[model samples]
Target: MALYDVLLALDPSPVVALNRAAAVAMRDGPEAGLALLEELAGARRLRDYHPYLLARADLLHRLGRLPEAAEAYRAALAAAGSEPERTHLRRRLAALAEAGHEV
Candidate 1:
């Protein structure tokens, strides 16, 4: 987490911020991470980045915001650059659906 903080302080790029958000999620809570992710919503670099969307989905899912998480997961699935990533996002969505939250 300290490493992420240093990286952010040095770069402060959207991607760096995204990674920092993940660290924040681990060290703090999903709410803290989600707040950081929300601050990056207007970042053009994240618009088509599956990682950013995936992070949002994961945080929202942790927060029990199933519908919103499902939406973000779908978006991440669509933007995924690899088959493995798509499969992961699909599993996440499927889990949400099994929990009675339809995407």
Candidate 2:
């Protein structure tokens, strides 16, 4: 995490920021991470990045924001680079459906 802070200070790269957001989510909570992601909403590099979308979806899901999570999962699914990633996202969407939110 310290390394991330240093790297971000030096580079301010969107990918590194996203990674730091994930780490913050792990150490703090979904809301904190979601806040960081919100700060990066305008980052062009993350617009179609599946991993960024995945992190946001996971955090929203953890926070019980099912509809938002489903939307993010849909976006992630669309951006996914592999069949396995698509399958995983599909399962997450199915779970949201089971929870009464359609993706």
Question: In terms of lDDT, which candidate is strongest?
Answer: 2
lDDT of 2 by residue, 1-103 (tens): 8988999999889999999999999999999999999999999999999999999999999998888999999999999999999999999999888877877
Off by over 4 Å in 2: none
TM-score of 1: 0.93
TM-scores of the candidates are: 0.93, 0.96
Best by TM-score: 2
Query: Per-residue lDDT of 4-99 in model 1, one digit per residue for the tens?
Result: 888889998999999999999998999999999999999999998988999999999999999999999999999999999989988898899898
**Least well predicted 10-residue stretch by lDDT in candidate 1:** 94-103
Q: Which stretches of model 1 miss by more than 4 angstroms? A: none
